[model samples]
Target: MAPSIQSLSMIHDSQECIKPIPAFSCCYLLRSCVRHASLYIGSTPDPARRLAQHNGDRYGAAKRTLRENLRPWEMVAIVSGFTSRVAALQFEWAWQNTKVSRHADLDGNATQELGVRICPRTAKEVKRVAKPRTSLTNILANLHLLLRSPYFSKWPIEVRFFSADVHRVWQVWLQRVDGLLNDGIRVVTDFAPDGISEVEGKELLAGAGRVGTLDVGYNSIKEYVEKSQFLLEDGERINCGVCKQRLILQHDIIAVCSHSSCHCAAHLSCLSSHFLKDKDSDSELVPREGTCPTCYSKLEWLTMMKEISLRLRGQAEVNRLFGRRQRAGTPKGQGLKSVRGRGHSEDENESDALQVSTGLDTVNLPPCSDGPWTIDCAIGVLGGIAHRPGGVSSGNDSDATVTPEIETHPQRCRRNQNTRTQRLGLQKSAMINLSDWYDAEVIE
Candidate 1:
């Protein structure tokens, strides 16, 4: 006999419970056990499984790694915290093509080494140039350059070294580099992927110690999310600590204080602006971390962003913590799209719909704003200080001179260009009204 509707629903729920959540994308460095100099770089959602694949112990090995000489392969390091597989893939491509990639720091003169001589060389000259061999040091240097590049610097990427020797080399490079990496980027050594003890994870979460392993960090984030769920449920009305505006849980992207006892909560953009107040606003669109407006406790921007991403994907654990039930007819992995389509009007542009579906539409401004800020307005406000005509001082110093050196800094110019491009992209795609785009869905 055919199953009843209730039975089918139970079956569906059981399958959903057991369905594995998508893992975070990571880019890994692999070295042949037989030949240490032979290396490969790739990105995958499952690092352990991918390592096995490369070692020929599993099916689906890459053609280059399937050779008998490189029988066994070991992962030297893995870079995690990429938001999507596409982002990880882009990083992998950039790493693989550093000499030609715009993200790399290779000098224009260096391009001649690949065979572009004065007045242009022939094809034979290019072939005779003999491509330079990629060394471990060169790989590490490129990795450092890519992390500091404007394209990937804003991401909360982490580099985890599984090999002691490689980790040591990474440290040596860090000491030799001209500038320090952003505080948000983590460099972990001797990282254990197997998991950590619960007691140790709790200690790390409590600020008594730092997370030394991947599992411990994941557990700490999970515990923090559980705590946030309780706080969100307890409050009848939550307001942004920075902007003093009401926050709608399902509709608005919000960030909570990392301190367990601290009840500070704020809109994502408002909190980002608050943290960037002391920073070079013109050069940076995102802040690495900041003190909580209410608690004055330090918070990591990466941790907050991870929590929001998890919520957007509607992970099973997040749903359980928030006491949310998936509707019977809703398909898997479309939770974000369903939530976005709730209050969207039919007349909205396709670009706006696409932006809303990506879960970034609410990032531009607070919900209570009368009108969305245009790209030009955002640029002016974020620029911090406005210069008068003819380079005159806006301050009381009538004789103050403007330094051409500071105005013409290459790094500063590149940063300003990147920031403006990002703002323009957001303004063009996400100018819809938040109030009309999302309706508060009461959770019982």
Candidate 2:
């Protein structure tokens, strides 16, 4: 017997005179691109709508997963249509469990609920939806896009299968990142500021790999600056000079010392170091257990360091670039009367075109190179040194051969001088002629 038209349709028609809430069954396929897994689950009544809702941020109990990492179109294996909603829900719960769900009991949901993910339309599909290149710049750009995405902004992404597991991972990564910044330690790979790059994403994954619970101590964060290296030391608590009770801000100028009898605000770094010896000897500690010796309160070193360091570095880069552009605008033959004030001669014009900026003064860019250096700057002196692997003999400023030593080998010195002169070019001088110039702008 042919099935009724109402039973076969994707959407329900209320006027069809079908049995109330007619039950149907179907199977849906979900593949996780991030984890590279296949999930087969069943659903009831209207599978299409249910699948769509699960993928979207709005409808599914899986909304937490959807908001943070999953995208709607990523679900690759969906074959819906089930005999009943209860049966469908049961299948969904079973599929979700193929992994782990630590918080399953609290939500009153099945342990094995289906999570949304992305995948190719079929196993045979070879093309990738996103480009494979993962350079630092591209990763940062992608993070910026994610930050502005509607999904990320809507809800707190529940990445934790169990509350304790996820929270613990996040807390540790945050601590390491904070500690480095506070100590003025800059990891070149982490060149971009926090929140601006995908460091959060990378750290989240990295933290998960590290197996251990955090052992944090609440104390003042102390550092010893020795020979340009900053080392972390133990924290101590002292009294505030003004308030006269206990204080934690060890360095703040409270106008008085922690001890009421001696109103001096200073405390020996050595004295504080001794006080912290009672705590754990581990190099890293949690900021909370750490206290401001002067204020006797929790030390929030990480939050402050991340914010301050990122801002300062960001501002420095901008200022350095700005200075470069300003210097580049200077005309090519300013002081050279032979080239400019002398006459508007053809030879002078040709000489001007050959001139290029030696980007030595630009601090933001990498040291310039003859060919390897992207910026046309003087920092390329480093490149000239490489040309002669034999190494140049050095001397004083009158005959300073660029290198920091005094030696003979006048011919080598001459060669070095020529390289420097050529690299310097006419970038700093006034224009010999307008015709000699070619347009150049700083890369945005």
Q: Lowest lDDT 10-mer window, candidate 1? A: 374-383
Error of 2 at 244 (Å): 19
lDDT agreement with native, every candidate: 0.58, 0.28
Best by lDDT: 1
Q: Write the per-residue lDDT of candidate 2 for residues 1-444, one digit (tens) a residue.
A: 122345434223332432222223333333332442322234434444444555563366343335435433222222222223454464455344422323122232211121211222221212333332211112222222222233222211111111222223233333322111122211111122345334344333222211111111111211111100111113445443323444334223122222222322322232233234435555533221234445554423332232222222233322332232233345553433422111221231122232232222211222333221222222232232112122222232221121111122223323234443422332323233322222222221
150: Cα error in model 1, Å: 2.7
Clashing pairs in 1: none
Q: Which regions of candidate 1 are displaced past 4 Å?
A: 1-23, 108-134, 171-183, 191-213, 216-218, 278-280, 315-444
* Model 1 clash tally, residue pairs: 0
TM-score of each: 0.54, 0.18
Worst 10 residues of 2 by lDDT: 223-232
Which regions of candidate 2 are displaced past 4 Å?
A: 1-110, 113-284, 288-291, 294-299, 307-326, 332-444
